[model samples]
Structures are given as structure tokens and as C-alpha cells.
Target: MKTVVITGAASGMGLSATKLFLAKGWKVMMADFNQEAGKKTADELATRYSKKQVAFHKTNVADSSSVKELKNATAKFFGVADSIINNAGIFTKGALHEVSEENWDRIMAVDVKSIYLMTKYFVPDMIKQKAGTIVNTASISGLTGDYNMAAYNAAKGAVVNLVRAMA
Candidate 1:
């Protein structure tokens, strides 16, 4: 069966995507920083689908070693991924001047650098395999600016352009 690694799989669209992929007969590796949510959701999904087809890994997508561990988990569970969904992101709402440097960095790390890190760690295998797909979950905010959402806008905007560059 085909396989997918979906970041942020603990909730929201990421969770939806995981269910959809599984229903479509794909093995899914659910990656999220929320260990409790991730494990619980994975266990629930396992009851509905084959347990072997779903695995959860606590991940800090912005960290290199954590991403490396994710890569290892992917290979250990499902081999080289057929697809990767870069859906993990965090939003900090504030005007640029009001946003804290820490908040800005967190947003950028999760929304932007995670994709870069995932690509850095995962793309080589995809390239060697000669067939793979990457789906980045960039928002409408990535396309248009939002009031009082400068950091998210900037971060997501970078995601939009980064996907374009990858394409």
C-alpha cells in the first residue's frame, strides 16, 4: 500500500487528512507534538483501521534531530514515504510591532522551518525512489494579508512561495 506522513495529525485538518488517507487505503504515519492527543487519536484510529497501518510519533517538526527521528520512524514503519503532508503549523496573532520575538520565532519555526526541515530530511529518499509527492497546507492567509495577523501572514506567505519554489 501507499504511505503518507502527515504532520500535525493530532487535530484539525491534519486529523481529517489522516482519516481520509486511511479510508483511501494508505498507511499513515501521524506526526504531532501532542503526545497525548497523538497517541489517543492513533489508538482510536487503530480500532477503525488496521493498527499496523497507523503509527504516531511525537515530533517537534522544527528540530533537526526530531525530524531525523521522524524519518527513522517512517522507514521503520512504512519505508520511504509515497507522500508527505506538511500540515504542521502554529499561528501567532498580532501586528508585526506587537508580536514578540519569541512568538515570531515560534511561528516561523513551525510554519516555515518545519517544511524546510522535512524536505531536508525526507526528500533525499523521495529523490532516490524517483516517485513521491509533497503537499503543503498553506492558508489563504498565505495569499492575502490579514489585519493584526502580521506574523502568521508573513510565515504562511513564506510557505506559499516556498511551495512554489519547490514546484
Candidate 2:
């Protein structure tokens, strides 16, 4: 069976994708920073679809090492991943000049750096296998600037362009 690895798989769009994939008979490796939510989601999915079909790994997408570890764990659990969805991100809104450095960094780390880290570790395996797909989530705010959301807009804009560049 084909396997999919999805970052931020514990909730929102990621969680919805997980459910859809499971319903479609795909093996899913759910990665999220929220241990409780991740574990709960995994347990529920496993119960619904059998343990062999669903698994969860707690991962901090902003950390390169964490992302590498997640890739390794997924490989060990289900062999190389057939696809990856870089769906993890954070939205922090503030005026461009008013945003704190810490908040800006956090947004950038989660929204932009997460993709870099995941692709850094997972893309190589995909390339070696000679077939795989990557999907990244970006918001409409990225395409058009929004008021009082400069940081989020900037980070999402980067993601949108990055996705195009990857394609």
C-alpha cells in the first residue's frame, strides 16, 4: 500500500487529510508537535482503520533534527514514504513595524522553515525512489496582502513561491 507522511497531522486541514487518506486505504504517518492530540488522533484512526494503517510521531517541524527523526521513524514503520504534505504552519498577525522579533521568528520558523526541514530529510528518499509527490499548504493571504498581518502574509507568500519553485 502507498504511504503518506503529513506534518501538522493532528488537527485542522492536516487531520482532515489524514481521515480522507485512511478512508481511501492509504497507510498514514501523522506527524505533529502536539503529543496528546497526535496520539489521540492516531489511536482513534487506528481503532477505526486498524493499527497497521495509521501511526503518529511527535515532531517539531521547526527543528531539522526532529524532522530527520520523523523521516527515519516513518521509514522504519512503513518503509519510504510515497508522498509528504508539508502542511504545518503558524499565523501570527501584527503590523510590519510593530511585530516583535520573537513573534516574527516563531512565524517564520513554523511557516517557512518547517518546509525546508521536512524536504531536507524526506525529499532525498523520494528522489532515490524516483517517484513521489509533495503538497504544501499556503493561504490566500499569501497571494494578496492583508492589513495588520504582515508577518503571516510574508511567511505564506514565501511558501506559495516555494511550492511553485519546487514544482
RMSD of each: 0.6, 0.7
Can you tell me which runs of candidate 1 are displaced by over 4 Å? none
lDDT of 2 by residue, 1-167 (tens): 99999999999999999999999999999999999999998999899898999999999999988999999999999999999999988887779999999999999999999988888998898999999999989999889899999999999999999998888
* lDDT, candidates in the order shown: 0.95, 0.94
Alpha carbon deviation, residue 47, candidate 2 (Å) = 0.7
Best by TM-score: 1
Clashing pairs in 2: none
Give the number of the best model, judged by lDDT: 1
- Per-residue error for 31 in candidate 2, Å, reads 0.5
Estimate the TM-score for candidate 1: 0.98
Q: Which residue runs of candidate 2 sit more than 4 Å off their true CA positions?
A: none
